[model samples]
Target: MTTSPLAASTVTADMVWIPGGTYLMGADDQYPEEAPAHPVTVPGFWIDRHPVTNRDFDDFVRATGYRTLAERTPERGAPGAAAALHVPGSAVFVAPDPSAGAHLDDLSRWWRYVPGADWRHPGGPGSSAAAIPDHPVVHLAWADVAAFAMLTGKHVPTEAEWEFAARGGLDGATYAWGEEFTADGVHLANTWQGEFPVENTAADGFVGTSPVGVFPPNGHGLYDMIGNVWEWTADWYAGHEPPRGCCAVRDPRGGHQAGSRDAAHPEDPVPRKVLKGGSHLCAPNYCRRYRPAARMPHAVDTSTSNLGFRCVVRPGHPAEGDRAATG
Candidate 1:
């Protein structure tokens, strides 16, 4: 087995060295998508200590002149080509009016396709990243994240790698930290504390994204692995289909792109990738996905207020040196 880095200087301060190991990858008691929990092994690698912040992404943009997919206008025949929503935009979370009696089943009650909402303007036109520079940068499509990875000479972590690191060596635990969602009323991560899409108690001192490292880190010293914002993974969003009788899967990636197309909107045909962790919008009454084993599928072209990403660098890979030189 590869040795873990002993000194922080060996890797960038923004990243932490994750010692490779085998761990239980999914949960059988939670969402159906995470059924049949199985064993998965991943190699040692360096991962961002927290989600990528607006300031971090801004630096990358300034250095590479890269534009996020959300900043570009959709083609005439694109899936979301409705004249009203066809303009360059992203999906932002807008809490529904509680008096309206919005139902949790209908996502449209809280999500809006807001024009001019991108990484720079998280909440539409007037919003800016000036004050919350350390907040995780949201509204990023898969292609946008790929662009960031290319510039930094890093790569998105595979589904197995992401789960392994998020678990923080606590195999089969209900959360990244522990079994309890909150320990003795103390919130461990940023998640909805009140009714979903209606009320937010802000008990955790955040209604939306919180500054990175605001919460306690996991056992592996990784922060924001369970909540803050959903993180992108390299694996395509296909149902987990483990080998029927296999003992364990080694470095399992994911499904094919063709298989990851949105079944609900088959006509649109845009492929989706796996998104790990939950977001501040996750709540007990609503999306109960604030766990390391939880996973979601998002269209490659879709971006949202609660979605962002971090990158990984495998040991012995040149990406770390390349990133250092670029800086």
Candidate 2:
């Protein structure tokens, strides 16, 4: 999976050494937000081959006695806290019946803020993550993800770093594996098969999150880089910034915190972070973001059943030294 000439001394069995280089960061043909494709360079780093699974997260929780944000009740008087936030819960996807004349535009028809719905209880009260130990752990907010990374001595990948790794050395390609969405009519990633929100044909053999590494890995040996679940990156949610002059930006990050505020509702200013990789909920008819250049914005304090993340260990970082010693 090594692509560049640079060598990595801290490669591990569970992590892939992404030989970093420059690549087109965004897409100009797909969604408008993904337009203005620009060139960006990243340093070589080690990234988890797959998104953090339930078993991996469970180990961290058991060792550190960590309770995720979704598991804690939010303060009623906290700024921007709504009545719904007073309860311990996370957003869960519940498909609406087409027979009920479900509105396609109203996401509330499909997403519900369920009480008691956290990573441990993905389906609210009775569901358990232990039953699907191999699946990517969802319902994690930014704070929870940061805490996990800190405990593991790893760091969340920035938007540039994530996109570079997702490309898997195939710069400017539409999908992670190549331009084709599928190979010989076989699904390569877990994605929606039918009309979104109401119908899911499950052609990929999954109605929700699938077990990690079930699909073929990308050129970098990174699994689930394009689907299964959207992954959080360490960047604020401002649109792509075009490169200046003719030089490709090196190790570019994201916008400032003040600029990351969601402008959709001026009355409620909540900051958002960039989320990469489309989830199993992605479909051609709806969110066709199951590509290397695809990205979305999500509030920092919010968590969803379809949102998850992976960790990265940059060269010379403490995590890199830890991996080198452990490996």
Candidate 3:
């Protein structure tokens, strides 16, 4: 969580270590809740080589005067129910004119949701940041990324610190860099290439959200984690708990699933809270769930613009304990 030099000059003060080994965390065969694929390890840390922009959350809401929860509170169901149903605030996709042959199962016909939007009105209220202040800093949650990682001392990386910084030191690669979704074809990772909802041939040049670090930086140099928006972790959405069923990894990793409003519509009761990397409306022809064992619970009252967050520094605390790892 040293990431403070904000004002987005492409926000790269550079850190991205991520050495840590032993992977194969979960899901190798199209989601049965990422069955069987286990194994762990994780040690070395230090991430955020990118992501957490919008002038570094507007200098962390102007040096901790902070407000974002969509500027306090409003999204509580109906009358703009958090920017239209379960929230998707500041939304503004619309990119549909590949000769008008579009699709994406009515992503609200093209995303919309807007309500004075957040991340300082990303695509709403006449959008500002003066010109994409290097994007990536949407409407954060997950306790406002643990209160901006305790106001920059750092803390918020847990889901095993976001799957050990998205398994960037690769192991059972589905993509954190490996197992080829395309190499000679060149479409490394930004997802939704085309026909996922109908037509997205922007071909990774841009459709929305893609300014974090442009792309290419995993093997632990973490950048964009897995597609743009959808960061937030420090865990807590519990469902189908296993693999030592969780609890005790140390440092912010506190979650193990249990907030099932529908756990895949187990009859839709309306639960929420659980959102990891996988945004820019991920479209592997139908919400590829944004791997890292794919998850999406969402409901800690709700708020969106694709969701956002990033921060962590608990290796030993105070001044980041010489880069954390102290027990």
**Who wins the lDDT comparison?**
2
Ranking by lDDT: 2, 1, 3
Give, for candidate 2, the lowest lDDT window spanning 10 residues: 1-10
Model 1 scores a C-alpha lDDT of 0.83
- Predicted candidate 1, C-alpha RMSD: 5.5
- The digit string of per-residue lDDT tens for model 1 on 265-291 reads 677677888899999989998788999
Question: In model 3, how large is the Cα lDDT of residue 234?
Answer: 53
RMSD of each candidate?
5.5, 6.1, 18.8
Model 3 — TM-score against the truth? 0.33
Superposed model 2: Cα runs more than 4 Å off: 1-12, 77-85, 319-327
Check candidate 1 and list the clashing pairs.
none
Tens-place lDDT per residue, model 2, 104-156, is 67887898888899999988999999999999999999888876776676788
User: What are the per-model numbers of colliding residue pairs?
Assistant: 0, 0, 17
TM-score of model 2 vs. true structure: 0.91
Of the candidates numbered 1 and 3, which has the greater TM-score value? Answer: 1
